[model samples]
Every structure is written in structure tokens, then in C-alpha cells.
Target: MRRTVGAEEGDKEEEEAEAQYHSKDFEWEELRAEVENDPSFCQHLLPFQPTSTSSSSSPQAQSDSDAWKRFHIRHSAGKFFKERRYLLKEFPELASCNENSKVLEVGCGNGSTVLPLLRGNENIIVYACDCSTETVERVKEIIDASNIISIKQRFHPFYCDLSINRFPTWLACNQCRDIYLQSQHKSISDVTMNNIMDSNNLYLLRESGCCNGGVDFITLIFTLSAIPLQTMPVSIKECFSVLKPGGLLLFRDYGLYDMTMLRFELEKRVGFREYMRSDGTRSYFFCLDTVRDLFVGAGFTELELEYCCIKSVNRRNGKSMRRVWVHGKFQKPL
Candidate 1:
């Protein structure tokens, strides 16, 4: 009355099931390619390419310039736009700061970091800057769309290229229109003079004056790796120039041999541990020692530095990817 399968039959059934599972798992690789090819997906994946006039003739310089231009376009399009929710939690410096604290988010695309920080702490003034005007415009859009009255008061967005030494001057010269837009309901003169000056708390010195000795915290989230390797030291030194004595520089960026780095083919390898993605965006992986040297070389004392390794699993594809990132806190001496 009972049916019993022989050991050999059971083994055969188990092998068939395992084989079917493996097929599905392997199919994910093919599916990923197809998905990447989709128009909608590509729109999100690829940034807008820069015109020839906008970039230099040198292939490497042009490539890097195009990559950043594309990133700004993609950011404006709402691709890769998400608030970093862990800012206050991970960096105690942000959490402990009082209402008078001033924080600058370098490469703050579309207000992803600034908006959240503003929402989290009303007393703190957040200064955000990006190399791309398009990205800066998007940040203004986000601030306007939020409809939060206090945000207009506390958030300052500007267009600045940190790779250059004269960023402070450039930031001072550019008018922050977001505050003006918010104060449009007021008298034109009031909005033009008082409101503009009030909103631009980051620039303690007016347009005629140089920006010096005001920043309390500076955040470089995945920003330094985008700079050309040769210019990284200059960028770090510039960060030193902006911060007040004892101010903290909080940084998070890709670490060496990350899964994203490992996925690059020989052709995509543009530099040492640096790769250009299919979409033309470039990324560099960093090692802890190298990061320490770069920060220390720029006169920052390391408070904390570590490599964070995380295994992310794709349940649909049954694939696991390793993500490695470096998180650190370096402080300027008092």
C-alpha cells in the first residue's frame, strides 16, 4: 500500500532538482545583460555625454570630464538620488554638534546629503556644492519641492569645482538663488539684499571678502575617488584650508578589490584599481594605508579608519556580491 523509491531513484530526483536550480541561478547572468540593454534601464545607467567643446582633446582628460558631466545629468534625472540616512548615526561628530555648527558637503549632488542633514538638525547650517550646475539646480529643485520653510533658511547650495584651488573664491562669487526663490513673496529689495546675505551663512565673508575660518565639519562621501589621482593631494589640502581648527572630516568611499572593481574586464581597467564603467563613469578603489597617507599627508590626524566589507545577496539570481568601502574620520589640529 505504501510506495518507496530506491536509493538510486532518490539520488536521481535530487540531482534533477539541483540541476534545475543551477540553471535558474546561471540564467541571472543572461538576464542581467538583457536588463542592462533595456532603454529605461540604460537611461538610468548612462549619464548624458558631454559635447566635444566642453572637454579637452586629451583622451583621458576628456573621458574623466565626460564621466562627471554624465553623472550630473543622471543625478538631475533622479538616478542615484537617495539621502544617506546614516549620517548622524555613524558620525558622532554630526550628532554631537550644537545648533551653531556648520557642515559642508563637498560634491553634494541634488541635496541627497544636505537635505537629510537639514531635516535632521534644524539648528545646523549645511553648505552644499557640486561641480555641475545641473546637479546644483536639481538640489534647488529638491529644496523647493520639499516645501519646508526652515530648509530655505538653513540650506545653502552652490556650484564649485573642488579640484581647483580657488574653490572658495568661486563659491563666494556665485549667488545662491535657492534662498532668493524662497523669499520671493517678500519685497524685492529685502529678498535681494538681506535674505540673500542671511541665507548664505556659509560664506561668512561677503562676495568681496575671502572665505576663511568658518566650517565645523566637512563630508566627502565618495567624492575624492572621482578626482584625477594627481589632483587628489590638492583636493585634500583644500579641505584643510576650509575647515576650522579641530573640525572633523568624515569620508566614505570604495575600498580595494570591491566586487564592482573585480567585475571590470581588462579593457575597462583605466588605471591602478580604477575602472571606467560601460556608461563612461569612472571609479577608483582605495586601500586603508593609502587613504591614511593621503589624509595624514594633508595635515589631518586620523581619528578612525577601517575597511567595511559587506556581502550583498541577490535573492532572485541567487548570486552574492561583495562590497568593500572605507570609512574614516580625520581631524584638523587645534
Candidate 2:
């Protein structure tokens, strides 16, 4: 079978359908009550305090990136690549945005998120990054194998360990990031500042200066959960700096009390709401409050935030599974 770009299919996991996109299959509070009341789920509720950052059980920020690098290498066969068709429904702005809208997909694993963004809007340009060199190269191969229009020009992939390092200056110049990071009391008016960060002016800056102004959208789908919990705030701030004024950040990640989170053994607990897999990659399940404080603290205005609760059936085991995901939209102040 030939691989094609943006072909929607019902994969066992993440089968993005309309009902799955909009409908609340179950109430999050109800699920929380059920999980909290059950003894089997009690361990996940236990509060955890890190004994030490250097503890063997606690995932180190340095090795965490290495673990992901190894993970992509092992699963680089494209098994994990699944198109998120319902993404356009969840965040329609990606499909409806103006021509040549720039999108930065943080931790662009297997190019799953990038493909739909490309298919939704022909004119959208996506710049994706992953820590794993294997993933970076693998996703490039997957997109190259596909038949998307202007694939070369529209899709750009690079390797960046975002948790530990700042984004390349080309994504946002010193001036653009300074506007968001520094004191607002500048010589110029806020209106004039925004106008300068506009897309047309941004490209012009790319020609003259060392960087483009900023991105229109940043997709944080399931990416933030994998970073070391300690580094999450800095990671989010990094994303905030790279977004254009008023640009939206689309986020979806594992949520608290999800079936997956509940399944982790007691030994897997590294920190509060954090767990590590055998292969070394970490997962952090999010609650609305935790999600809000992180982004809002980083200077984004919360536009939409909620728990996406759904019940899915395990095809092989023939058992019902309760799934929870945090969905959110945040925008930088204009």
C-alpha cells in the first residue's frame, strides 16, 4: 500500500470522528468521582513529593530527551503515525485562517499533526521540530513519501530539544520576544509594535535581520506531557515567546484519571501526576487547574480549556476504557 498524505482512517487509537471531537461522552467530574471512589484507582490519588531530582526513579531532564531519542528510533517504522482528522474540527481556525499562516508544531512526532494542518489549508506553512534526530528524519521521509502539494516548500522539519534550549532565533527575533518578555513601557505604542510583528513585516525582517517575527499558531498536542515536569514552565514560556502577538496555541494532552494514567504501576511514579515508561519517556497527565496556571502564568489569555472525556473499547481485550484528554486554546495578548 502506498503512503499518502492526510488520508483519514479509523486507527485503533485516536480515531478522530466528529462525535469524538465535540461530544462529551462522559462528564469529567463523574469520572473523577468514580475513579476516586474505587480502591483500584486510589494510588494515582496519592500526593508525591520528589525525594531528589537525582534519584534513579526520578527522570532527569538530560536523560529524558535521550529516552525519547531512543523511543523514536525503536518505533520509527511509522506504526505511531496516525493522521488527526478531527483536529480541524477541534480547532477550526487552522482550516479557516488566512493564506500562508505560519504554524509551529512543537514535538512534531511522526508528523501526525503536521499532515492534517497541511491538508486543511493549502497555503499554511508548517515548521515542525522534534528532539530525536531519528524522528526528525523519519517524519521528513514520511512527508516526502506522501503526495501533498508543495511538500518541500510548505513543510520544514528540524531537531530541537526544546525543554533544555531556546528556539532558534529564526522563529522569533530578539525584538519580537523582547516585546513579550520585557517591560511594556516602550517608546512606541502597542499598536505600532503589533503592526511591526505582522506577517508581511515579519518576512521582510527575515530578509534583513537574523530571524522571522513569530508563528501564527503553536500546536502542543500530547507534547508537553513528555517533558520533565520541572521543565514544563520554562518549556511553555519558550513556546509563548515564539508566537506572534495574538497567535493561538492549540493544546491536547493526557488528562488526569485517564485509563492510561491509572494503569501505571506504583513504581512508575516519578513525581506528582508524573510517570516514566520502561523505555524512559515520561508522561504527565494534566488537570484543568494545572493546565491553566502554567499557560496563564506564561502571559497567555486562556480562550478555551476543558477535559475531553470519552469511552473507547479495547479492540483486542473487548473491554470498555475511559479516556480523558485536556483540550485548550490560548492566545498571546495583541
Candidate 3:
């Protein structure tokens, strides 16, 4: 039921506790100093060299989405989804934004980010997408099961691989109402979600064909790193294309010298600052410079970028673990 992706149960709980207090408990420079000064962690800092099994044409690279699909299926049961209540604190605009302001959540896993946004802002409309259809449906199920008001109308889940494909035109179609989202009810017997991601299908009912619009905000909460580094440029460009002028893009992901990065074995290294887990899913750790380049290079104006370093103690072993995460906010030029 409860699967701790990278950290153990104690560390995850500690993180949740730490979030309630501060975004930065210690300086990232301090952690970097401690890590770099130590010789044992040298392998993670060395330049990465690709191996045959880890090549771009390898199965791991080709099936990254498939790997995530299997990940969702593996943890499908018993309800371990943690609602990210802290997101509202980090991005208060979502809680106090204009009514009916549309937001697109890329790689919304298990509704951790969705539930809070839905609960915090009843008037906001969230259109969530993931590479896995199974993950998409599961998010709908998780959020629908919550006791929020009119969520059936505000929460829209669709299947699309944003890494390889662009968002559906209907998402940018100003005159359309996703009947599939608006018409959802207690029983979804009549509605078929098979074509939810296609603008040419019956799933979308439009008033006009104008596709010159974009969402007010896009939340990339730990979403970008799942993708292969090579495809990140196009993926970010796709995100930039779908955001309205002056729209904000919220970002968060693993930071360069985090404890997890140090824990990875040298053999797990697939690319510079990148590693693959036993489950076949890969994680890319970002430094501030890399984060800035990715967003700015995609034509976004960087507003805020920094490292969040938090130290949490593992209750089981009384061991201390320092976690590092990148936090950022970028806006499309008005």
C-alpha cells in the first residue's frame, strides 16, 4: 500500500514534518561541502559515461513511460497516496488566483499535487496528464473519492505522453468545454475515456475550433526529471507552448547533491547526475544552473530558482539524512 519511492518510511514522514516548518533547514553549500570534502562520494560527482545497456537506444530509454506505467500498476492498491498540502504554501497563487483559472499538471502522480489544489481552490480548473492511462484513471479515482465540492466538473484527467506528444488542441481551444469533464457524474457508464486525449474524438465537444489559447499555469512538481535528459528540451518547449503569456510555471525536483544521489551505486549511473533505480525508472538530479538553462532556453523568464536543503532524522535508526530539492518558478513573457 505505502511505497516510499526513494526514501524510507521514516524519512518520508520526516520530510512531511519538515515541510510544515521551513523550505530550507540548512544551506545547500554546507551539504555540498560535506559531500565533496568526503572522498567516498566522488563517483557521483565524476562525469558520466554511457554503457551499452544504458545507451539512448536501449530498452530502458525507449520504455521510460512503460516503466512508469508498471510502477503505477505495482502500487495501485491499498491507498498510500500522500496529499501534497505544502504546495499551496509554496505556490499561493493557486489558492488565491482568479476564478476559473485553468492549470495543467504534467506527470501528476497519484494525485498528491492534485488533491491539494482542488481542495485549496474550488474555482480553479485542473487538467492533469500522465504517460500512463492507468495512472490517469487512478488519479481520477483518487480525487473523485475525496469529499471536495464540484470536483467532477473541475478535475480533468487525460492520457498523453507529453514527452513524445504535444497536449491535445482542445486544451488550447478557447471556445470548448470538455463535456467529458463537465458531464461526469456518480456513474460514468455512458462516458468512454478512451479518446480523452484526442481533439478529433467524440470525447471533446467544442463550440469553436480556435486553438490559440493556453493555460494560466503549469505545475511541474517533480515531473520533468522522469523524462530522458535528451527529450527534456522538447518537453519543456511543449510546456512553454501551452502556457498563456505571463503564465507561471511552478517547478520542483531532486537537487544535485541530495542524499539520494549519494546513495546510488556507480553502476546505476546512466548519465551525468542521472541514475536508474532497480524498477527501471530513472531520476535526474538538477543543479540551479541546469534548471535555469532548461527553462530560460525554452523562452521562459526565470522568476525564482534555489535549492531546498532539509535535514531529517530517521526514527528507525536514529540516523540523519539530508535531502536536497530544487525549487523554481518561471513565467512566459507577457
Give the Cα error of residue 127 in candidate 3, in Å. 0.3
Model 3: residue 167 alpha-carbon error in angstroms: 0.7
lDDT of 2 by residue, 144-228 (tens): 8888999899999998998888999878878667755553333466657565554455456567875767799999988899898
Off by over 4 Å in 1: 1-63, 170-212
lDDT for each residue of candidate 1 in 85-142, tens digit (9 for 90 to 100): 5556657568668776889899887676776677777688888887777888888888
Task: Judge candidate 2 at residue 15 and give its lDDT.
Answer: 41
Q: Model 2, stretches more than 4 Å misplaced?
A: 1-22, 51-59, 180-207
In model 1, how large is the Cα lDDT of residue 141?
83
Measured on C-alpha atoms, candidate 1 has an lDDT of: 0.63
**lDDT, candidate 3, at 215:** 87
Q: For each predicted model, how many residue pairs clash, with residues at least 3 apart or on different chains?
A: 0, 0, 0
Candidate 2's TM-score reads 0.88
Candidate 3: 10-residue stretch with minimal lDDT: 1-10
Residue-level error in angstroms, candidate 1, position 268? 1.2
